[model samples]
Target: SMGNQILGGGGFGTRLMSEVREKRGLSYGVYSGFTPMQARGPFMINLQTRAEMSEGTLKLVQDVLADYLKTGPTEKELDDAKRELSGSFPLSTASNADIVGQLGAIGFYNLPLSHLEDFMQQSQNLTVEQVRAALNKHLSTDKMVIVSAGPTVPQKPLPAPTDKPAEQPLGV
Candidate 1:
C-alpha cells in the first residue's frame, strides 16, 4: 500500500508539471513528493506560478491523480523509475549524515546491520508491477489533506468528491 501510494503520487506530480505547466504554460516548475512514515505522513505539491493560475494548477493536480489511479505506469515508465532510483541511491548514501541516519534507522527499527547492504539489491529487484501494486494500495487522493500558506492564495473550490475517507484505522 505504501509503495502504491508513493509511485502513484510521485507519478501524478510529474505528470501534472509536464502537462499543466510545461506544455500548457499554466505554471512554472511544479513538483510533488510524498513522505510515508512509520505511521502517517504527507504528500505535497509545490508549484510556482502567478496568482491567476492557482485554481487551474490545483485542478490539474486532481485530474492527474484521478487519471493515474485509473491507469498506472507503463513498463517503460516503471523501468525508468527503477533506473533513476538505483542510480541515485549511491549519491544519497554518499554523505556522512546519510550513513549515520541510516544506521540510526536500523537501530531504531531493530533491523540488522545488513539492512543497509541489502537495500540496493532489494530496490533493484523491485519490478514495475510491484511498484504499481504498491501505489494502488497506498495512494488515496481522497484521504489527502490540503494546506496552503501565502498571499494571493486562490479561493478556488477544493476538488470535488470532498468527503475525507477514513484512514486505515491505525492500530497498535
Candidate 2:
C-alpha cells in the first residue's frame, strides 16, 4: 500500500519517474494510486522492470517514498489538484447510472445525503498543510507490504510448511 501511495499514476508518478526510472534505470514505468472507500482502502504501486533489477527496483521504490513523504506537493501543485478535483466532481454525477451508483454508495457506507453536497466545498477548503500532513501520516515507507511476481527468485528461502495434515495426501 505504501508503494501504491508512492508509485501509482496519480500524484506520486513524478517521484517514480524521477527516482526509479530516470535516476536508477530500474523500471520502464512506475505508478501509485489510491481508492478511498468507506475507510482507508488499498493504495497500490505498480511497475514494469527487467527481472534482474527487481530487488533494486523495490529498494528504489522505498527511497522514492521516503523522499516524497518528507517533501509533499508544492503550494501551486496543491492548488492545481484542488481545482482539478473540484472541476471533475460534476462529471462523477453526470449520468443517471453515476448518480444511482453514488446514491447507492452513500446508502451502503451510511454517508449522509449532504456528503455529495459538501464534497466540492470540502475539497475547496482543503489546505496544503492538511494534504502535507496526510501524506506524512499515511504514506510512510516503514509501514508497507511488498508483493512481487516475476521470474527472479527471492533472496531468502520460502517459509516452512505448516504442521497441519493435508486433507488428501500429495499426488493423490
Candidate 3:
C-alpha cells in the first residue's frame, strides 16, 4: 500500500503525476492504487488523455513503471511519503464516523486492535528496498490489461487558419 501510494496514490507528488501529468502534460491526471480484498485485489493505473495521444501516453506510463521497478524510490521520496502518511494518520479517525468506519474495516479484516497504529509505524519504518521488493513481487508492466475508450475514427489534422474572410468584402 505504501509502495502504491509512493508510486501514484498520493496527489501531485506521485511518480505517475510527476511524469505523466506535470512533466509532459500528457494527461490531466494519472494515478495508481490497489484495494485489499479477501483474495488478491486488482491493482490499477488510470489516466485520461486525448485519443490522439493515448498510445504515447500509455507507453510513457509503462516506461515510468518499468523504470520505477528497476530503481525504487529515493531516500528523500521515502522520507516525504512517510511524513505525508504520518501527518494524515490522525485524520483517518478524527471523527466518530471515521472511527466507526476504521473499526468496521479492522473487524472485517480480522485485524488487531492496534492495527492502525501498527500500520503507521510499519509504514514509517519501511526501507526503500522493502517497498521495491514488495512491488516487484506483485506487479508487472508486461501483464497489464490495457483498455481504451474514445473515438475510434482516426483524428485528422486541424485545417490551417485563413487570413481572408470566407466572402471577401464586395470584391475588396
Best candidate, lDDT = 3
Measured by TM-score, the strongest candidate is 3
| After superposition, candidate 2 runs with Cα above 4 Å error | 1-13, 17-28, 35-39, 153-172
Worst 10 residues of 2 by lDDT: 163-172
Give model 3's clash tally: 0
- Write candidate 2's Cα lDDT for 72-118 as tens digits: 66666566666666677799899999999999988988988999998
lDDT of 3 by residue, 20-111 (tens): 66656666679999878866788999988777666767777798899889898888889999999889989999999999999999998889
Q: Look at candidate 3 and give me any clashing residue pairs.
A: none
The C-alpha lDDT values of all candidates are 0.60, 0.64, 0.80
For lDDT, candidate 1 versus 2, the one ahead is 2
RMSD, one per candidate, in order: 10.7, 12.6, 9.1
Which regions of candidate 1 fall more than 4 Å away from where they truly are? 1-13, 149-172
